[model samples]
Target: MSPILLTVNAGKSAAVARTDAPSGLTGIDKRPVDGEVAVSAPGPRGVGGSGLAGDSIADLRHHGGDDQAVYTYAREDLDHWAAELGHPLENGVFGENLTTEGIDVNDTRVGERWRVGDELLLEATSPRIPCATFADWIGERRWVKRFAEAARPGAYFRVLRPGTIRAGDRIEVVHRPTHEVSVAFAFRAQLGERSLRPRVLAAGPALHSELYRNATAWAENA
Candidate 1:
């Protein structure tokens, strides 16, 4: 099936936080918005295109930046979760800026580039790391471990060209790096899975700097 955007979501303020969660602050509480949302590159240490014009990033240290400018989750994956959890899963519930359909997000290579709409260009950078905020947001026990075991952690993208994107926008894979390091591979490597760590090298400089360094170190030790 052709990849199409199912929803465009953004958070105007700090995502709803829970005192019970490990991290009290989070920006995962995104909601779908109507019409077109502007997509643009962010300034240094700034929020990127997916963040929307008035969106907020509560924790700058770990989330929001050029490398993780846009977050995408697959509708197919959400469907799986919905069946497992016995509830309807809505777009943006996973904290993704784009809810996409017909895309194998986990299988996408680390350096894949996507053309959304007519002008926006985005590059896949890394897989999202399940955080305490995510666990609480989903209200699942052992959520992080479960999410990792599922190996369906979606991808984060870096904005290449700025434009506007919305629900129903066409998504095309414009490029795919030769590297065998898919988002799932990178996610496993980030979890200290030595066997998969070497795949990170295939991603070359396309990997996030910190992740690239950590993966390189692990591969060297291996």
Candidate 2:
């Protein structure tokens, strides 16, 4: 199967659930949309949220920004989790803006650039760091620990070119940086694998600002 977008998901509204979240609400209940959805950079974190026009992100401090304008997860990963958990998982259930097929999202290089549809250009920036809200939303025991241990946190992208995206859009990798820092490796580093910090820092400017800063500070102190 060729790499393509399986679904475009956006939160319908913020729900007053997820006590683990700072806002006492969660926008993780994203649902598949029928038609085209506009995509663009949503500025900086804490102020901007979700690149998809109608999407809502309740936790602004941790999610959404120019670096995390879009979040993507693979249907394959979802399938793996579904079988492991003895239940079926729906698209967008993980709060990903895009659910992809036939792509190794976790293995993607941190600086890779993907062209979605015709004009939506997205640059891979970082991996989703499972949070308390995500754990609460999943409603599984030790979900955060399990997710982090699995080390397949999926990929987050920064929108470089704004355009409309819908289900079935083709995804083409137009560019990949020379660094070996991949989404999985970055996630491992984020999870306290100090040995991988230097390699993650090698991604340099292509890395998300926060990750880069953390890596830089670690390297300096080490």
- Residue 213 Cα positional deviation in candidate 2, in Å, after optimal superposition: 0.2
What lDDT tens digits, residue by residue, belong to model 2 across residues 96-145?
99999999999999889999999999999999999877888899999999
CA shift at 102, candidate 1, in angstroms? Answer: 0.8
* TM-score for candidate 1: 0.92
Candidate 1 lDDT over residue span 1-222, tens digit each: 799999988884453556232345566778898998898766544333334555556666677788888889999999999999899998889988999999999999988999999989998989999987788889988999999999999998888888888899999999998778999999988886778876688798788777888878877887
Give candidate 2's error at residue 75 in angstroms: 0.2
Model 1, residue 138: distance off in Å is: 0.7
Task: Provide TM-scores for the models.
Answer: 0.92, 0.97
Error of 2 at 81 (Å): 0.2
Cα lDDT listed for each candidate: 0.83, 0.91
Candidate 2, overall lDDT? 0.91
